[model samples]
Target chain A: MSDANEAANEPIAVIRTPISLDYHYSAGQSASRFLRAIAQGKLLGQKCPVDGRVYFPSRGACPQHGVTFGDEVVELSDKGTVVTFSIVRVPSENIPLELPYITINVLLDGADTILIHVLDAKLEDVRMGMRVQAVWKPKEEWTTSTANILYFRPIDEPDASYDSYKEHI
Target chain B: MSPTLEKALTAPHKLEYTYKRSLGPVLSPFFTALRDRRILGVKRRDGRVMVPPKEYDPDTSESLDELVEVSDEGVVTSWSWVATPRRQQPLDRPFAYALVKLDGADTAFLHVVDAGDEGNMETGMRVKARWADETTGMITDFVFVPA
Candidate 1:
């Protein structure tokens, strides 16, 4: 709303709407199969033929080219390398994250695009391109979100240099 | 249609968002200042300093770093009357909210103006910040009063 026409402006989008319009309980069907595997102690990603790069958290269509991929739903390695990161000093609501946590964008061995996950390793030693792997909780603690993969950290692979991933930042 | 299928055919829908911001070195200074009870702004190329300062230049995307002080007292740059207030607004009763340029600052911010009735508040009305007795350094800590 404009302060110039401020006095005349009206509030919007507040009312008791109908069942059809009121609450959308679900989206039409999405990547339920990939998500289902996460609950069953596994991680799956889709591979795109056009770019020959695997996508974690499967996209129905290739994000860059828009071609649909169905044949290559495969389990991803627990090991990955941190491509970039940010240390969050403050906490946000319902984030399910511990404060002073570092969120790292990791490029897994099989996938082309990197995915973000919580970093559970020491805060000071955390660096970019440091090799890390998933630390899943005991079988009792799996659920809908990727939080199932407790954290990622350097697993001994040589660190990647800044020149290797300049565009990713 | 049976009553159960009718219920199954319909359910609830919700949209939610969690925006993650990467604080480039410039804006981190601003947020860190907020965490420390101080306010900050960036001096723009056009000589207009902006509050809640942005990291990149408004036009050229240059990294802006000149930090300046802004007074709690400011003029209403622009305003809109809330005849029917919405959820999360400061007041339940009808009110006037305005963008006021603070006394020592070059930019404007939105806040609640405590005018008894909607009829008295005007576009050019002057107001002052009424700080909360208890503050966590968030935007909600201030309510404006008629100056």
Candidate 2:
């Protein structure tokens, strides 16, 4: 650091300005198909030809297979078993939800991959292998966005067997 | 397949930032011209004038000393059409983004032309600077328009 006397001796003009650049991003092929299915209150998954593993919110290509899944998408059930979760108690300005919300990774029925979403259940009530279903918003408000399904909530059924989702965890 | 998903869709995104730049002795006068609604260029030892004047010559790396006034009017050397203007662009409507060689200056300056349509824009077309109502010591203080 320079001394105050040395700083005063140097001659320079400091120009401070603000800049904002706006962009329009295009969601690629696989995500586009997944988002379209979400608008219709449906869930879609894609399977890798090589490993034969199913990925929700289709990635279009499998890194393992090194091949693109062109028009080879599969339908997935909305019901799922929670593999893991974290209770968010810390309040942040960017989080639109209220405090003490539980965010969980659910392994949907017949899906090899897990989907991360907010689960509307009491923090103490949320447990691993808890069965949950998607709660869709009104059809009129549907758009090509995942927001169509508001959030996941527990069904009135018994907890799922750990063996069913242990591999996913 | 849903018709909406048959093709690509665009989503809005914004990046915001503030930048601060320190100007040294050689380039200070160039930006000061923008404040006074004037334009200045630096002359190299070989007598070539560079607009938006640089401190040193590009070829010889010699320190530039002489600053000369260049006419705001210039000829458009090359240009491309912006059918859909992006946010914060100089103009809200269609315009031409061009590299203009200002009069008495050897180098070209990058700016936009407010020509009504692409058909109206052509090579060697004359353009003059359109100053803003209020002056600020920034390159965006003025833009080029058909003269």
Candidate 3:
């Protein structure tokens, strides 16, 4: 072998094989049940009597209260504000949104935590506190999946100001 | 129970991961040196130059300070062999996974080798990197060739 002065160059890599777990483990069917509700154009939120708001894809437990919730399903207003957002450039498995799609944390009316969903409005026009409504696919096209409701976008009318929803963020 | 169920072969289920780690600061220099066909180690608090350069002292947890260059040659300090592999392993064929301590480094590092058969591998045998042609910054980028 040669010294640092004469050694032939070689390369090495630190690869990241990032992974995410899906319902295949313990809750795929449960998640599907929640997804089915969204496809029907209704907003379903789970109530954790003591713990309060947990919306969609089934909130089996209230992380804050640490109590299990078993109650009647209820619907909330579909309208919400973009509490925060991120545009994912990298794609992963099971992601329905295309590149440059807006993934926003929407605080639906009456829910404590925000629900992550695709934003349907154009990237340039998107602003914080902009009021958006969930646009559901036609009744025939609905599926038991969140992708069933295309994405949230600005409602046809006026938008909300930053001050109105700043605290919610 | 049933004839159809009896016909179904049931073998062990397994999930294996052949992780390629980017050694970052400390191990990065060593791997790059390997690609450049050189060997290097980092000098640690105990004055020992550990190969596959460690970034922090295992005992004190302080950042490793200096980079030390070593000979590509080393002795096989320890080893494990795969008679068969599950998935993502470097080779589809049988091979030995060994810990080699290059000449100037005090610690050893892991890599694979096609040392033919189990009878041919020895704890003290010398070896060198059989570097890949289009090397990526990864350990699989090399297979050990007899030195």
Candidate 4:
């Protein structure tokens, strides 16, 4: 026990455990309608009856007024402005992208909320107020998952004015 | 939307964290003993031994270092029957998760017991450790079995 070399030679116990939880996730009424539309290459949002603010991929209720949105579904544009973003340098098993990719919080046009998604562009090219458009996967590969939209990419449109989406950030 | 498609979209999702961690101090030797088909416990201030030893006393928060050997055979103090096993459970078939108080140890250790049937599981039932074919200093190195 007193020998430092002996302690260093001893095998330290290490546990390599991969923990996992598998369950069926039911996307409720609002998300179901949104996913259904997105499968068809359309973005759906719910208009708040009180403030008339549109929530993209709505949670079926307005958080501010706590009012349930009925069939007031509004189609939103795939184009959006990058309000904020981060460069992910670490590798993950789930994300297929290369190292150092940009993940952006986009404020989609006609929607009052932001959608957190990956932006496919050079690291130095991504910026706040940068206009980006959704890049969809092939039609045949579309499913009930938001992953159907591969990622957003910088478009040729002008950068959105700071005052336009200032309240969102 | 069509009535069939209107049903809420449901999909199977699996959340996982795959990582390796070092079993430091007390647990390192405890799990290392399990690899050699032996059970070790920590001696508390009152001399009562705790199986699956902790580095610090739970009540007094005193650092403990005295490691004691305990018998693999023990009595099931309590148990809950698992009629159907989940994907990550130690056993693939039906089993009982029991708190076993090993001989010479005061604290009960939580582990799965393969009693063959739910009807065989009961408080005070004697169980013995069934070692895995290959041991790697992990808790899954052995499971409990009706003695």
Choose the strongest candidate by lDDT.
4
TM-score value, chain A, candidate 4:
0.89
Error of 2 at A167 (Å): 3.0
lDDT per residue for candidate 4 within A58-79, as digits (tens), equals 7679999998887768999999
TM-score of each: 0.46, 0.52, 0.61, 0.87
What is the fnat of model 1 with respect to the true interface contacts?
0.14
**Off by more than 4 A, model 2:** A1-21, B1-5, B15-147
Worst 10 residues of 2 chain A by lDDT: A1-10
- How much lDDT does each candidate structure score? 0.68, 0.83, 0.69, 0.88
User: Which structure is stronger by lDDT: 1 or 2?
Assistant: 2
lDDT (10s digit) by residue, model 2, range A1-169: 1121133323325555557787787888778778878888888999988788898888768867788766778899999999999999898644699888999999999899899999999888999999999888999999999888889999988899989888888
Residue pair clashes in candidate 2: none
| Clash list (residue pairs), candidate 1 | A23-B12, A23-B13, A24-B12, A24-B13, A25-B12, A25-B13, A131-A154, A131-A155, A132-A153
Instruction: Spell out the clash pairs found in candidate 4.
Output: none
Candidate number with greatest DockQ? 4
Mark the regions of model 1 whose C-alpha exceeds 4 Å error after superposition: A1-30, A161-167, B1-147
Distance from true location, Cα of B30 in model 3, Å: 4.2
What is the alpha-carbon lDDT for the whole of candidate 1?
0.68
TM-score of chain A of each: 0.74, 0.83, 0.68, 0.89
In angstroms, how far off is B121's CA in candidate 1?
A: 29
Per-residue lDDT, model 4, residue A138, is 98
